[model samples]
Target: MPAPPIDARSQNARVLGVELCGDDGALLRIMPLEPVGLLRAGRFFMLRRVDGTGPYIPRPFSVYRQYDDGSIEFLIKVMGPGTRSLAQSSTGTELVCVGPLGNGFPELEAGTPKVMVAGGIGSAPFYLLIQQALAGRHGASLAPEDLTLIYGGRKAGFLYDLEAFMDLGVRVLAATDDGSAGFHGNVLDCLHKQWEVGNLPQTVHLLTCGPEPMMEAVAHEAAAKNLECWVSLETYMGCGVGICNGCSLATRPDGPLGAWPVAKACVDGPVFSTSAIEF
Candidate 1:
């Protein structure tokens, strides 16, 4: 079994700030007591208020951003008590933070066009990924034209941090269910449209993170198209480490993780190739 990174340890982090974003989300920033070195885009942290104001079990959040000052940000949708507590946090508030956990997205391949499909809050991890790809931080830097983001939501407001992503100078398209945003459909539909119009190549690498059903649909599409695809599962985790058996998912018998009947989302991955796991 794989283990959490050696640098993974629980520590108290001080709240630096919280900014309301999107329709019902907050960009919560905190400074860990100890330095957490460079973090990969999709890696996450387990967080909870130190004052015991929220659930005893800390909630997991993807690392939205990591600044030079050693502070990290989590783009949290104010959906439940766990997130609400974090949103209500004030400067100087202390919270327990665990990790820099799990494997992030794989390195970018040169000459392969990449398309990212994000749903609502699932857009969290892509920010850094796009930034890194453009900056050549990931192996084989990509041009802005080589990267595309198809961000979707029920409405415009769910497409969190839209302008920020656009500022990166990559192709960013919006999709909304109610026709209130860019395209009058979901992300998958938007993606198909791009291909149909020749805005994107038929053969391209795909990466997605969002609601389970959305991810399932994208996975099915990838399988049918025989395209290489990866998914960042938004699984419910009791513990962001391997100690708890709560985040297990069924594995594909012929896939890379087939040796194991099941894989733990926490340590094994929050990111896995679509071929390695069943939807």
Candidate 2:
């Protein structure tokens, strides 16, 4: 398995600000004491307040966006004490940040179109992916037309930072369980409709991050269509490093990761080819 980046280390960070997003989510921004250079889109960090306000164990969060000034953002759902503490943090609140962990998304192939499916807060990583892809930073440069984002949420209120994603200049489709926004169904239904209408090609690269059930469904769909797909698992991590083994995922017997019975999401990947691990 791969190891954490050599630059990964625990350091102090100070809250820049926290902006409320969607109904129960927040965009928490912090400036790390040390510069972390540029990180791949799907790489993540473990964060916890230095004060005794949240869980003793730090929570793993995907890098939402990184700024030139050594600041990073995390799109967080305020569902638990750990998240709640981060959301309520004021400017200058001290935090422990450990990261640039795990392998990020694989290089994008040229010519093939890419369709990203995101559910709720899972949309976090795609912003940077789209940004990098358009700039030709990830791999072959892709035009805005070559990329599409299908974002879904239980309700419109759950589609956090929808406007910011739309501003990225790529086609952004919204799917809500209720008919509060864009399409009136889940992301899978939205995807099928797009295919049926010929809005998207039959063969395209698929990337998804979301609730386990949603990713599983998307994986099965991609398999049925014989399309390549990758999933960024939102697995819980006790320690965002190989030592804890808290984020182990069972490997597929016939897949690329078959050499090992299991893989660590923190070091090996939070992103994995659908074929490498069983849903």
For model 2 the TM-score comes to 0.98
Model 2 CA deviation exceeding 4 Å by range? none
Report every candidate's CA lDDT: 0.93, 0.93
Give residue 231's lDDT in candidate 1 (0 to 100).
96
Q: All candidates' TM-scores?
A: 0.98, 0.98
Q: What digit string (tens of lDDT, one per residue) describes model 1 on residues 100-204?
A: 899989899888799999999999999999988998886788999999999999999898889988998999999999999899999999999999999999999
Candidate 2 structure lDDT: 0.93
